[model samples]
Every structure is written in structure tokens, then in C-alpha cells.
Target: MSLLDACGAGSSSPATAGGGTTAVLNMPFLEDMQVPDPDIMYEGEGVQVMHAVYDGLAQYKPGTNEPVPLLAESWEISTDQLTYTFKLRPNVKFHDGTIADAASWVAGFKRRAAINQGPAYMVAGIKEAVAKDPTTLVVHLKTPNNAFLHYLACPWHPFAVSPTAVRKHAVGGDLAQKWLQTHDAGTGAYTIKEFVPGNYYLLEKFPGYWGGDVAYDQIRITITPSVSTQELQLQQGQFDVITKGLPIPDVLKYQKNPDYEVPVTLGGTGNAIWINPNKPMFADRKLRQALVQAIDRTPVVQTSYGGLVPVQKGFWIDKLFPPNLDPISDTFDTAPLQALVAKLPDKNVDLAWGADGGAPVQQMAELVQTQLAAVGLNVTVRQLPTAQVFDLANQPQAKRPDLFIDWLGGDALHLDTVLRIMLRTGAKPLNLFSFTYPELDKLMDEAILQPTTDKMNAMYVEATKFVMDQAIFVPLCSQPFPIIARNYLTGIVQDSDLPEVIYADKIGRKLS
Candidate 1:
């Protein structure tokens, strides 16, 4: 059935709030989510759904990267940092009426490892996961990892699932992969009521949720691809909020409206241009450096995002890594770039941007294209859906775009997340350029084993500087996290670890 037919979406009235009535939160998805299963889904949109339907061992404290207790109330780490023991909360039950405990977590980890999808790397270091007892779970890693706890807190990390349900639904040893695509077996506050791909997903409050007294009774998420349509629906009280794809102009417009609450903060995400070194034109180090130095980022940031997002200062986002390192300049001389471009046999370059990025990213690409053309090159700009852009990573080097512009943030606040996921060898999906260096990979490997925060940060600094000097990835600007919601919607918190995800359980209606 269609979303409108199932949810009565044609109603003109806004969702009812307070006065002991069902509080439904209406939101829109800029693109259809891949799947709600935590083990397989890694994208931000799907992760949002997973956050509502699943509970991890730990979660980042609201507005901070610090790992705090969730399903696992308290945890202890070995001095060597190779072993971790977690104490699960008592009497927790999944949406399917199954108990959640040490065994359930162990099974979940095993299932994730066996499935071997994109997010499986998060748990690859697991040497063994054993149930010390009903409430105590012990995990041993192959090597010391300082970011282990942070990985557990990531939105894409392994979450507890119903072992009984998993076994019962297993078809030909599929580990319930098919069953989980449209269903949920988590212990979180919400359960998937209906999952209609490319249409809508309806999440109802799980009556047996361990967390007592959730705010919204239902969360209705419809696939609304157009940001303008989402804005209209929100204005007409059809949609309560537009989480993603709202342009900066509309964001500023809503900020002036008293009826809407627009919370804008410095997000962990940063926009960058990834130059494919495999391309013959960019193979030369001088040409790559010239390409990066050609663009003046000041106008690009101002014209595209209306000066809302600041030009990026470093390879990583502000305060995410240590300061005092050299900053990337906003402006550069194009004379050297022009000289270098004159020598190139092929000046034609294919530049692509994510369509899900909306209009700002396309504008940024056009501005860059203009800047590059002034330096004696022919640039062709193309807009592709975000999923198709990710698929480019798997394509052969000959088939990939010469340059890709997109914004990326770590799964967690740890420096390893950015270093290892985007630049490391064979990092799929996000590593569109397929840029890899053995020394860089080894440095990150050493950084993860550092004993103290200072030492770890120092290693990361060295790594960041090394990558910056390579000039393959050009930093553009910092993306500000903005959530436009109705004034009555309260408790909207943004986590630094996962900026794009809004925790549904934390949301509440402001009673009149």
C-alpha cells in the first residue's frame, strides 16, 4: 500500500500534541533509506532509523563525543586496552518479546561479523566475544585499540538483536538478513510498524521498551525528495520538520519566523574535493598541487552557502583535532596553475557532486568549475544521486569521475574514523578517489595503538599534515548542522558523533 493511503497523509490538520493524545512526529527523507538493519546500513539516513529501533552497548552523551551507558550500564577496559567487559542492564526486552542480555549481544556481534558488510569493519578487531554471565559480556580484541569504546558508541556499530528471532527467521543460513530488511528486533524505544521502500516508514512506540515513557507515540517518515515540497508541507502543517536537504536561504527564512525553531551549530562534517590520482591528468604531483591552489574558497563558500559555512581551516573539522597546525589558505595565485594547465595534453575534467546535497553543493561545483576554467581547463559538471556517487568507489578507475565534491563526517568523533575510513587503502564508498599510501596507512595503524589521548592526538596530527601535503583531497568548508522544526517540538538534541541523526526517543512536545 502507498504511504498516503496507509497513514491518512492527506489530512490537512497538523499532528496532535499534548492533552493525552497520540503525539505523532511528521518528518521527511530527502532520499529513500537503504534498510533499517543496523548491521548492514551505514548511510546517515538509514542510521537515523536504526537509532530509533536499536540499542547499542554505549551511546555518545548528548552534544558530546564521550561514550556513556545505554544498554550496557557500565563497562571496564583492561589496562592493555585489548579486553572489554560490559555489564548489561537488567530486564531489557526486544520489540519481539525476546530477552536482551550477554548472549544476545554475543550473537549480534557474530552475526555482524558473518554477514561481512560495510559496517562489519567496525567489529573486525574482535578476537572473541563471550558471555561471562547472563548480564556480563566480555570482548577481546586482536590488538590494542584506543577507539574501541568510541566505535561501540557509533551509530553504525553492532547492536543487540533477538537471538531467537534471528535463528527462527534464518533461511538457508542467511542469518535473517532478508527478514531484518523490513523488520526490527531491537530493544530501543520504537519498533518498525511498516517499512515500504521508496515510500514511507512508520515507527510505533514499543510497549515493552526498556526506556520508560517515550515522548512521541509514532514517527511518520515519508520520502519527500524535493526540499521545496518539504518546506511547503511543513508550512502547511503537513510535515512537522525538514531534517535534511533544506537550503541555506530557507534555513535563514525559517530562523526569522517565530513559529519555527532553527537550531544551527558547527557540525563535524566538511566539504572537500577528491581528485583521483589514477587519472592521467592528476598523476603528476605538481598538477595536483596546482589544481588545489587554483581555487579561491572564500567566494565558493560565500556564494554557495550564503557565508553560513565557514571555509575549512584544516583537513579535519575545527576542535576535532589539535590546533596550531598549518591552516589551508582560502585564496591562491592562479598564475602557476595556468602554467601547469598549459602543459597538459588533456585539460578536459569530469567533476561530479551528490544530488542529495541539494543546490548548494552544485553551486559550489559550478564555482569551482569557473575558477578552474580561468586556469585553462575544460570542466564538465554532473549531478548524481548520493547512492550512485558512492557506487563510483567500486567502479574501475577508468570509469570514475576525475573529481568528486561531497561532504563527509566520521562515524564517531575519533580521528581514526576520518583517517582510516576516507583515506586508508580500500576504504569503500567514501573513498571515491581511491587514493592510498602505505606510509599513511601505517601511521594510522600506529595512531590507533597510542596509550594516551595526547600521544594519540599527536600521531593523528602528523598523519593529517602528511595527507594535507599530498594535495589529493582539497578542503572546502565546514557544514553547519541545522534542524528546522515546529516551535512546539522540544528536546531536539544533536550529537557530535552522528550529526545527521536525530534521536527520536529524546524528542517531546512542548505542552501548552
Candidate 2:
């Protein structure tokens, strides 16, 4: 994805209300988000909520866009690349007045790894976790995993977990996952004061926070449906800060006005329509290539992003991904691209196009239909429920659908988030969304267990090639962070890589 400085929103939205000091920005789609507990959050939206009222061993800095130590002060990894020792910060207490120790962290992780117990079972890639000392935590790997650090930064990992409260709450049935689906227990800077599902949540700073002090004393987060509601509420002075989901160009027009501050934070949240290769029609490389060439990305980029973000290059970080993203890098190799599209066997293809029952998705689906049809392949745009998109992608072979239109992203934990969701065979389908390819697994193993620089690149290359060969997911575009905040909402730092809610500790009010 192109950096934020490169893409530009057409204009910023105007602010409303008598007290412009009380900024209200909007994020529509919170109703689809369910953050029942610290462990179980509504994917990306959950990350925002987790940032405000929760703390992990490592915390993200909104301004610097870095993850600093929150619970764990310092740590070490063996040169052999197997044993990882983590030393916890002492005297950290949860809102419930329970002290967090190494054992607590270990137990918390183990419980999280339980079947459906924690949202991060994927993070527990290895077989086991152990706490050797009160201040130290160790994870023995069945194989060396260098990307584990990135996994640790994930909100669902050990950093935000609390063992004592989790275990106590999880006595009868499988409690950890259940507790996480309902409760919040962590040693973060803030604690949940009140939680009314589908309504709003209030958070108060934790006085016992080991860190000097949190800048914000209170955080008020209310749920808003639809993107328009987020914008409407913010305009009405009902919000302090909001993120523009996927950067609709019309939304950016507000930035043209000087009344409200419109900051474009270069976030890692990318927007792309991933095509599943497992489908019989996508099974043909020709059809896949034809499809890529068929759909003109210009309209989506112009209409959806308003010329702010750029067309995405590859799956991983733009340059961080293998193959230098040189200027001509965006150019498509039509030979291979075309050859794949022509090779598809005559068969019915159902590309899972969950058209939000809207014109854009429907239009895009029509374009794709026409493009593939040109190559003598029949394409069925199966309009499905949004929720089934990911499930179908991750479903097992027999039950899986032919294709899915989906978006996956990464922040500081770029490789982990992308690779795990894209490759990690351990997930439901064994190969994430893509059906398993042996060569793909070998390369991933080399990157994970072998740990060689050149080999790592080779694996990524091989993996991308494998993805291209299968035509599983076709890349589309990236999204930019459009932020709106109040004047008194000082210390508001938006980390492009992480979520917006991390500002909980840094946010403060300035009474003029």
C-alpha cells in the first residue's frame, strides 16, 4: 500500500455544534462489531475498544506508531531462536485489585489457547506456554517462530490477559472464552466503568497503573450504526474522535474546511477484494488473470478513496513484501495474467461477492462478470451475507465456496497478521482462506522454523507465487486513516499501524 502522504482525501467534513471543543467524529459499522470481553473483540473495531480500556505486556504509542512496554518491562530471546523469556513489570494491579504475576500471564495464555476460550488461539502457535518465575515468562516452541513478537502485539494475546480473574470466572464450563466473551480484566491504564451492550461504554483511568499516569481521566465510547450515524453524531457534537472507514472520497470533503481538524494518519488498514483460488472457475489461471485485467481499479480508487490512497501492490507490506516495489512494479504481466484467465475449464464459477446489497459492489460484480465472460468463462456473482464471507474463505474444502471478496490488513505485526490469516494451516481450513499447497507450507515453515533471511524472502516469494498460481485472492487497494477530533481533546495520537483507541492513555482535555 502507498504511504498516506502519497494519497490525499478530496476534502474534510465540517464540524457542527456550539461546543466545537467537544469534537465528535464518526465510525459507522459499530453494530456489526461485538467486543464482549478483553479477549473477544470485534476484530478491528475490538482493537479500538481494547486500546482505550486495556493494557497488554506491550502497548502501542499513538504518536510514534510503536509498541512500548506496558506490563513487560524488558525481555530476551535465545540466539538459538527457540526459548523466549519475558520479564513482567512488578506491582501491576488489575482494576479488581488483583495483582498480575508471571503465573497469571502463563495461565491466562493457556486458557486462551483452550478451545474457543480466547480470541488468540492462533497466537499460541506453539504447543505450550510456561511461567518459570514470578517476573519471567517462557514459551517453548515446537519450532522457532521469529514472527512471534508481532503476534504478541495482537490485542488477543497474553499482554492484555489476566489469569486470576479469568480462572475464577471460568470454574464450571469452559470459562476463559466465556468470560472473555462477557468480562474485562487486565492491568491496563483504564478499567470499564459501565458497559451497555449495543449502546455505550465508559472507562475510568486505573489509579494503580504502574506507568506514571494516564493523560485521560475518563473515556466515553458510544456505539453508532451506519457510517452516516457516525458522521451525524460527530456533526452534532456527540463524539470526540472518529475514523473514516475505507476513506469514501465524499467523506473527505469535510477536510476542505478549516473548522474541524482532518488528519490523514497512514494506517495499515488496507482495502482489497481478495479472490479465492479454490473455486473451480478461479481454478483457471487465465480466468484469474482476465479478471484482474477486467476490472478497472480507477473507479474504485477515485470513487471510494477520492484519490487519497493508492492501488495496492502485493499482499504483504508494500516494500517489505518480496520483489522490490519499484516504480514500474504496479505494471501487470499480461502474459501470465492472460494465460491464467484463458486456461479455466468450462464450468460454473461462483465468486462470493457479498454485495452490501449496494450499487458499487453490484457494479463491481457486473464488471467482473463481463470481464470473465469475455474469456469464455461463466461467472456467477453469488450475493451472500457479509458475515459468511470470512467463514466461507476459512471453511474446509468440501464445505467451502468458490470465491470470496474480503479485506485483510496488518500494522506493526504486519507479517504475523497477514501470513497467519493468509497461510497458517492451523486455522480452521488448515491453510487459512487458501486451500493447502505443500510447497506453500514448506516455504512458510522455512520462514517460521529455519529463520534465514534469504530463505525467508524465498518463502514469501514462493508463497506469493503459489497464491498467484492458485488465484486464491486477487489484490485491490489500500485504505487511509481519516480522523476528526475535538479541540479540547488534546494528546490525540492516531497510530496508522494500530487502532485509534490507543489514545486512551494519552488523551486529555484542555479547558480554554
Candidate 3:
């Protein structure tokens, strides 16, 4: 299939350019705009900007999940799969006009490791990145990591940054974190023209882009935090595309217009309510199972999400790597759950979540509260902004909520990422739930080090079943990213791997 076909982009809407030159995208909320640096960002909105402003050693091909040549012209893996050698594309230059060579990449990798921030785990396995020669970059791994390429292809990893730029901006060996928070460093399709945290940002096409011509000369990203406001702006012809965060009802309303197409695809983290087993309330397996059994996902999917999203019965890993070994049954039975509830001395519990997932999470949490209450359990829902929720999650065990309704979307397509980052005992500090499952931890370690895909798949399958049996978290649904694009827009490709990010490099207007 062609790239557009792979991206699922050919709709029947009549084509005509609304804006003569600029293509505008509207996002409901931005976690922050400190996007010039990749190490600190955890949100997918940051990834969207990274896709436009930086070039990785390798990247997933546009519209597909397969890794293709990006900064590296070609690459070879060692027989043991512990070593990688990449051949850099010749004549590439960073936005600062410095040559991007093997040494450039080596400097970036070392700097990223030193900073040891949010995405450092991606390259943490790398023992060293050496400059064998001007065009040759060699990487030595601590172990055989099956997901190495997928990690590099993810936006969270360290992309090629100009060594000269970093040196010039450094103060007290800070690695230019302050300057890069709002500046450009790599060779990408677009350059940062303007950035203003939560308000809006503008990007201009870089004529010197090594890949090729970028479709949009300028991309203006406006932060419209209200679903209603974004829908109105889209209708008023102010936005060429309304990005994710539009409520499902608003998305459904816009689908009726032949002038627009709301493309919905499975993306981001699978939605779930995390149970801190450390808490006394959720300490019992039966009690945790009871909470899961009480939730009827039918209304949450149909009424809240308008059926745009699918019910996620299996772990998110099942969506990508699956024979779906031991998929968690979605069958709801409240009898055992009620019996367990009767045994508890205190039935009052707190359900914490954010308003970030749009209307679906809010409605689901409310519905869960009402349903659980029907079974003679008192549930209190605590709502917080996205940042504050994360803050609470990182707090001490005593202060954390009983449960947090959120999604733990691995940044890449590998099961190792999902297992190690989210499921492995003591892995997720952000969630602040210190869980100790020695056997499960051993299984996860073996899964990542397994040299073969078949063996790796088997281990991950067993791990998924173990996690579900424990009822550590209640799996909800796989998030469906909704995009409303103007009918005239062509070359709109959503990355199959990084579905949260939308590519504008190939986006252009269609002639009627």
C-alpha cells in the first residue's frame, strides 16, 4: 500500500483549499511548550513538535510502523544483536549550520545520558555511542534489547542535536536545558519560528531539510483548551485540523459535515484505573477484583465515548504483539465483588483522575462511582489537572489516592517498554506505587533479553496473564485518537507507531 493508504487518509469529502498558504492545527491543551529539549517531555504533544523539529538516527516510516532510514542512511545489527553500527547520511547539517556527523550523535547521546531525564530510559541500555569515523556511528548495548530500534524511532528518545549549539548555550555544564526549552537544534523539516508555552507556536519550513521539501511552508499551532472553542474555531475556518482532545460528542457532530472527516485510530496509552496494592484498601486481591467486576464498560464506551474508542479487554501490549495469551475477560459479575465488599471493614474509597482524557474519563469515573455505590461501597471521585495528578502520583504512599484513573501508554511499540516501564516491580516512580512481585520481575527481565521474537513473545504473554490475574489495575479501553481535518487537506499521515503525533511534512492543500 502507498503511504497515504497505510495512513488511512483517502476520504470522500470535496476538496478545496480554505487557507492560501498556512496550515493550522488546534490542540485543546498542551502539557507545556518546553519542547526544544526532548529529555524533559513525557506528553505526546511534545512528540508532535519533535516529529517536525528533529531528526533521529532512525525513524518509523511516515504512515507505517516499520523503521526506515532517517539521519542514518543504513544500519546493520550484530549477530548477537547487542551491537549496532549506523552509516550517517552525508552532507547533513543541523539548523545551526554545524555538520551532523558521527561525533555529533555521540555528543548528543552522552549529553542525554548525563541529564538522565524523562526519556533517558530509552537509551539507558546503551553502554556507549562511539564515533568510529566521520560517517559511522557505533552503539554498544549493555544487553540485547529487542526494542532498541523502536525506542530510537520514538519521539521521546535523543535525536541528533548540534554539538556546537549545545556548547554555545551551556552554562555550568547544564547541557543547554534552559536555551533548548524554546530553541531549535536538529535538522528537521521545520524550524522553530516562535513558541509561547500554552498559548500557541509557529513553525516555518526549513529549505535545507535533508529529507526533501516540506509540504507546509508554515504551520501555526494554536492552543485552544476548550472542546467547544476548538469546534467553533474549526467551523469558522480558523483551523485546518482539530487535533485530539475534542470531546467525542463534538467529534460526532463534526462528522456530519462532508467538508470534514474525523479520522479515528487506536493510539496512545490504553486507559485504566491504577490500583496501588500498597494501600490497605486495595491490599486484598478479591477487593481489587470486586472493583474491576463492578465496572460495566458498555455505557462508558457507548454513552461517554460515542463508540469512537474500543473496549480494551487485554493489556495494551496485546494490541501490538498478540496471540493475546490469556486475554482478560470483560464479563461483569458483581456477586463475588459484593461478597468481598461485605468483608471490608471500611467501604469508603477515593477514586482520583484527571480531566485530560476529555469527557470519557470524567464520565467513566462518575459511572464507576455510581455503579460501585449500588453494590454498597462508598466511592469519592477526586479530580485534578494533569500536572497535579502526576504530582500526587509521585508523592509518598500515605498521601497518594486509593486509585488513579489514567493510561500508561508506552512511548514505543515494544512489549519490553510496556512491561519494564509500567508493569515491572518498582519501575514506575511517577505512579509512586511500590509493588514487589519477584517472579513477575524475573519474567520481565528474561523477556527483554530473549534474542528471538518467538521466545520474547511467549514470555510477554505469560507476563500479561500474570499481571491480569493479580488485578493490579483495571484495564478499560484503547484510546482512539480523533482528528478532524479540512477536506482540502492531503498528505495527512498519522504515524502507525506513534499514533499520538500527526505529521505535517507531507501535508498540502488539494485543488478542486
Query: Which stretches in model 1 have alpha-carbon errors above 4 Å?
Result: 1-15, 18-21
Q: Candidate 2 regions off by >4 Å?
A: 1-29, 59-68, 116-132, 215-217, 319-386, 393-403, 410-412, 424-426, 429-434
How would you encode candidate 2's per-residue C-alpha lDDT over 1-512 as one tens digit per residue?
Answer: 22211221111122221243322222333444465565445345556557655666764444343456667887788888877788888877876787787787766665556544325544466656677877888877767886676556555545556666766787576655565554578776767777666677666677888665865555666666465666555555555467544235534666774435667665554545555556555555666655555555655545555666676655554523532621113544335444564554555656555433233344445565665565555767766544455355456655655655544454344444565555655543223355556676666667766566666666667667666665555565554566675444556666536444445566554443
**Models ranked on lDDT:** 1, 3, 2
| Better by lDDT, candidate 3 or 2 | 3
Best by lDDT: 1
The global C-alpha lDDT for each of the candidates, from Candidate 1 onward, is 0.81, 0.56, 0.74
Over 4 Å off, model 3:
1-35, 61-65
TM-scores vs. true structure, each candidate: 0.94, 0.80, 0.90
| Count of clashes in candidate 3 | 0
Q: Hey, what RMSD does candidate 3 come out at?
A: 5.0
Candidate 1 per-residue C-alpha lDDT over 1-512 given as tens digits, one digit per residue, 9 for 90 to 100: 33432332222123345346677788889898887777888786777788889999998887666889889999999999999999999999988797898999999989999988877878899999999999999999999999888889887878988999898898999988899999988998899999999999999999888888787888889998888898877876778777767788888898898878898766566778888889999888888887788778888888888777778777677735644554666668888889988888889999988886777888889999999988889999998787887687788988888988887667776778887778889898777778779889999999999999988878887887787678777888777667888777778877666566787888876654
lDDT of 3 at 309: 67
